[model samples]
Target: MGAATTVAQNMSLCDKYTTALLKDNNATNQYTLMILLVNTAVIGNYTTTPAPKNAVPGILANGTFDGKAVNLLPYFDGSLLSSNRGGSSGVSVNFLDGGGAEPLKKNLPANDKNSHQYTLLTHLYEFFGVLLQCSEYNKNPAFPAYAGHDMESAHRFMDLSPSEVGYFIQQVGLSAASFGVSQEDVTAVGNSLNKLFGYRCSPPTVVVPEQGETLNSICQNEMCPLDEKARCDLYPNNGTVVEPARVNGTGNSTGNGTGMGMPNATASGTPGFSGAANRMGEGVISLLGALAFVVAL
Candidate 1:
């Protein structure tokens, strides 16, 4: 948390997140858009290969929303990592959103630069996209189009239940603390993540559980090589078994499409809910920071 906090705080004025972080275009907010990009790149999210390149600048240049460009490339390049971490060689991130929501929500057109949510989601999507690409998940037989990293894998592992997803969010908090990421930034990310999970992306997603099948079984079943490597790397000697989701009738439950569904609502409005979305988001940032530390290792 300390290292990450420093990075967030020390980010230059031009590097902060577009809104709050940049007050009067001079005041520096801890969590800036550039911080997200820097963290994403540190975790090896940006692609340097390919003809046109999916590097930060190109992606922002090509992607737009609400008639405005989402370009933050000037603030981030392969050089940012070298300046901050003293090295430029990137590495594959070992962590992933257990619920698989990151991959699912990443491609939503609504999340494009047009929506207010774009700034936050961009980090989420790019971080996960890069993770998927650099990891074995990109190579899974289920997603052959990504063989050359041209296309992102579209497999859904609706393996996590609402409660489990919440737990993942909590993990982000712990991870962030360990890495010295600021609590304020973590809270902001938490709020954003909460909104993200319950965001109800356009063209609702429906997941049909395999009778008695649970999220844990799916996450644990025929695990991809990338996931296996990640689990080992992240958990190491600690026998930290991933938990399963409990779908009783409490907490922010992502409905199963049929009848057990609910719109994306906050914990205040909804009963038995604990705002797991924000937790998940904060954890993601923390995990990214942690991964960046790993890369530095």
Candidate 2:
């Protein structure tokens, strides 16, 4: 029962940590968070819960997965290029200086037909891999809590595999060839994935002494003061260490009325630490300022 309770508490802590990790911008932090999750799955005892076949149906149903919802193709389609002057076209080519008319406005066949599908599939594949690894971790007995649940269920939902994951990565390259996300964004995501899966723990650095050496030490040849001897008289046979009282100054007193010498105010500028009202006021002010600036501009 104690083990079960500890596992439950750890699981809750892991959930909170994971949420915070997702919100972080650092790839290392995200990878560390994932690693923590994997470690927890490996070490903790978990109760298995049934999951639906379609792990990301919400993404599909909400149109986030396909072009219908998020329209990721637009971000990657190189043929749909926009110029500094706001001119739009599929591809730019400089023709010979002959009098021949410029070629009719057209889209790059490579970009329009093949690239989009490849890019979408690639994103899907990578996302699926992370999910699959999570499932595998859940299945391992090193973590007893997740034993009953099938991590493979996520695959049935997403319909992806290792081969597909590679194919999708290739597709991302093709997509990048067309729609140009800043190279930095692409690199960041790639680096994050690499680090998340690649990290290894180093061996322990410290060794502990034997129990007898640690437990048998009592009072050695240390000299004691008369006042200390008097205090020891209060609890002669007790095993607990008694801390001596402070002999000088206004012991432990703070000058502030609140005792910590700090203002009892919220960071949000409200009177109470729970500054819900102050936040609402700040939000309203920001909204109004934005509206006014837009109107003025």
lDDT of 2 at 158: 19
lDDT of 1 by residue, 117-142 (tens): 23333334333333212222223442
Give the candidate number with the greatest lDDT: 1
Query: How would you encode candidate 2's per-residue C-alpha lDDT over 85-147 as one tens digit per residue?
Result: 112222211111111111101111112223333222222322322332232232333211211
TM-score of each: 0.25, 0.17
**After TM-score superposition, what is the CA distance of residue 274 in candidate 1 from its true location, in Å?**
20
Candidate No. with top TM-score? 1
lDDT at 248, model 2: 38
